[model samples]
Target: MDIATGAGLLAGLTVVVTIILMGGDLKAFYDTHALIVIGGGCLASTLIRFPFVAIVHGLPLGLKFAFTMRSTTSRDLVDELARLAEVARKQGPVGLEKVDTDDAFLAKGIRYVADGYDMDFIRDNLERDRDNFLMHLDEGQKIYRAIGDCAPAFGMIGTLIGMVQMFSNMSDPSKLGPFMAVALLATLYGALVANLFCLPIADKLHVKLADEETNRTLIIDGILMIRDSKSPTLVREMLLAYLPEKHRHEEGEPVPA
Candidate 1:
């Protein structure tokens, strides 16, 4: 689980709730109009920017990221590749066919190798596919950023509308404060959603992309090394080089084996 994502979101919500309760009138803050203004506006804007399917699919992923954890770690990926490398060395590339079919991303390269595809062909195809995958992710993040940008502006608009309505009733000066509160509240809610939700998800997606790239590259190198029947120690060393500098080690060193 991604503790950082979970902790950050929980802390943010805790602070918001604490502040709202301290305001002494929780019901006043829970305005239906405010909900319509902020939630409705954000959703409408997001829908306009992204496809219906994307929005639907992303909703659960977004909530999961916000409330829990959803990211792969470098060590987990490195370990998986290392294991695959060992398997390929023992039984040749054809051995990986079973594992490949299960994971779409890994399956592509593994299948290419099992089919006796040339090294250049496998590398070119995997690299092209990886680039396309990364580009698709980038586009998705851009959509989320666009939605984040729209949410706050509409929030400000909601505040202005509320304030105008409040000022129209000059006889009831008491409404002035509430109207101002609505205005400020909308802006707060908008900014919160943008900063705490949309942008953060985009950032998380970016991180995931980087980690996947590393994993894919490691697999590419490992596959090539196995195809050439390189020594096990040398193949392990080459794959290990793709990892972060801190993870690489001397030939005889203990590696949690």
Candidate 2:
């Protein structure tokens, strides 16, 4: 699991709960009408903006990515690719067939080399796949951002409705408190949902997308090097450039030919 995402969510909730408890009358915050207006309207507006399929599928997937730990990192990909390059150099492209890999992208690239695909064919296909995946991630991000933007507007609408009701019922002093609660609580719920959930998740998804793209690009480079029969040491050196300077120096020196 992603500790940062989990921790951030826990911390935010803790703070919100603490403030509510300290203020007393915690039950006052709950308004069924406010929830229906803000939450329901936000969902309706978001569905209008994005495909229903994307909203239904993308949200859970995006949240899973944000909350779950990634199976691999960029450094792991670099090291694995370097090893594959070494195997290819020693035993040729056919050797890669015996190499077991959990990563589908890496496996596909190796298969292409073993199948004698030209450089252009390999590069074009891989780039297209990467672009398509990135486009989907972009759509997911936009969906979350749209929810964040629409939520506050719905909250304001709820507030206006509450005000209208409150004014119309001004003759009855008993109704004023409930109407005011609806107006204020709707705004609170909207702000909380947007800032603590939607916006943050959208930002996290963007980070995940960038990280995935970087790893995929690294794998592509490694596969191309293996296809060209580059030495393992050279492959290691080339891929190492993708890391920070500190990490670059930490890698073992290239093996002597």
Candidate 3:
């Protein structure tokens, strides 16, 4: 779980409860209707905004964004590249054909090497993939941001409707507080949905994009470095520049060599 999200939720709930218990009339709130409008509105709007297939495909990606931080580092990527280089240098590109190609970033390079593609084409194509992946991430983040912006606006709309209903029967002043609370609830729900859910997801997706870009750029550098027949030691050292200083010295350590 995201510590920031967890802490913010706990703190917000505590404040809300304390405020309500101190003198705020608990009965005047319109949380249920707020729930219906925000929940139903967000669902309907998101469905309309994205294709059903894309939305379904994106469900788990979004959930992953919510729960997981991208953790693969430059050192890990450099190590894989160095190993690939060792194999290619020993037996030529044909040797790589037998290697697993499950990782998308690594698979692209392996596929290029396996297919006997020229070094220039291989580098250009893999660079294109990196660009496209980053573009996809940016586009995805925008969708979540749109939803975040809409949630609050819909909340305000719901509040207006509630006010209209309350004022229609305004002959009794006793209904004023109830209607006011209901109106306020719309803003609260909108702010909560935007802040707690949509915005956080967008932010997380951004972080993923940044980390992924770093890794893919490392892949690009490694691929080109290997294609140029740069020494494995040199390739490893260059890649380590992308990592934190702590991982640098390990680049030269022998693995029983």
Candidate 4:
């Protein structure tokens, strides 16, 4: 799980709830008309922008990407690759068959090496696989962003509709509070849905996309280095370049706590 996403979302909801309870009960914020306008409008508009298939598949995929952490990091990958370098050095390509990796991409690279595929052949296939996976992540990011953009606009439209109804019914002062609350609630819901949910997830996915690209690229280079029988120390040195200067530990130095 991604702790930040879970924690951040929990904190945001807590704050919203606290504020709501400070003034009134949850029922005060409930408005069927406002719900229809914001929820229905946003959904309908998003459908116009994206295909049903893309929305159906991409929305859940985007959420999964947002809430889940990457299985491996560049530092971990470097360490694993360095270990594999040692194994390949002693037992040659066949040694990699005994290794197990949670990462599917890295596992495929190991399989290729163990099967004695040529360096060029390995690089070409891995790069193709990396590019294809990246395309889906990119699509998910765009879909979330599109929903975020649609939400606030629909919120304002709902507010406008409420205000028009509120004004027309100035003859009934008792209805003003309910009418006004419903109107403003649309804006609140829109803001919350967009800011608390859609936009943040979209940004997280964007960050994940870049991180994935970097890690996959690092793995490809690492695999190629191993295939060429590079020394474990030398493989570690080259792959360390993929990490930030802060994360780049000296050979004998312990990794930062």
- Highest TM-score model number: 4
Cand. 2 TM to true fold:
0.89
lDDT tens digits by residue: candidate 3, 89-135 = 88777887887744678877877877788888988898898987676
Clashes of each: 0, 0, 0, 0
Over the stretch 1-257, how does candidate 4's per-residue lDDT look in tens digits?
Answer: 99999999999999999999999899988889888988898889888998887777778888898999988889999999999999999999999999999999999999999999999999999999998778777778888898788888988998888898899999999888878977899999899989999899999999999999999999999999999999999999999999998789856888776
Estimate TM-scores for all models.
0.76, 0.89, 0.73, 0.90
Worst 10 residues of 3 by lDDT: 248-257
Model 3 vs. true fold: TM: 0.73
lDDT of 2 by residue, 82-137 (tens): 88888888888888889988788878998999888999999999989888777777
Q: List the residue pairs that clash in candidate 2.
A: none
TM-score of 4: 0.90
Lowest lDDT 10-mer window, candidate 2?
248-257
- State model 1's lDDT: 0.71
Clashing pairs in 4: none
Please give the distance, in angstroms, between residue 39's alpha carbon in candidate 3 and its true position after superposition: 4.5
Candidate 1 TM-score to native = 0.76
Q: Provide the lowest-lDDT 10-residue window in model 1.
A: 65-74
Tell me model 3's lDDT, rounded to 2 decimals: 0.77
Model 1 misplaced regions, further than 4 Å: 47-83, 97-104, 172-178, 250-257
Tens digits of per-residue lDDT, candidate 1, 159-229, equal 99888978797689888877777787788778887888778877887676676677777767766766666
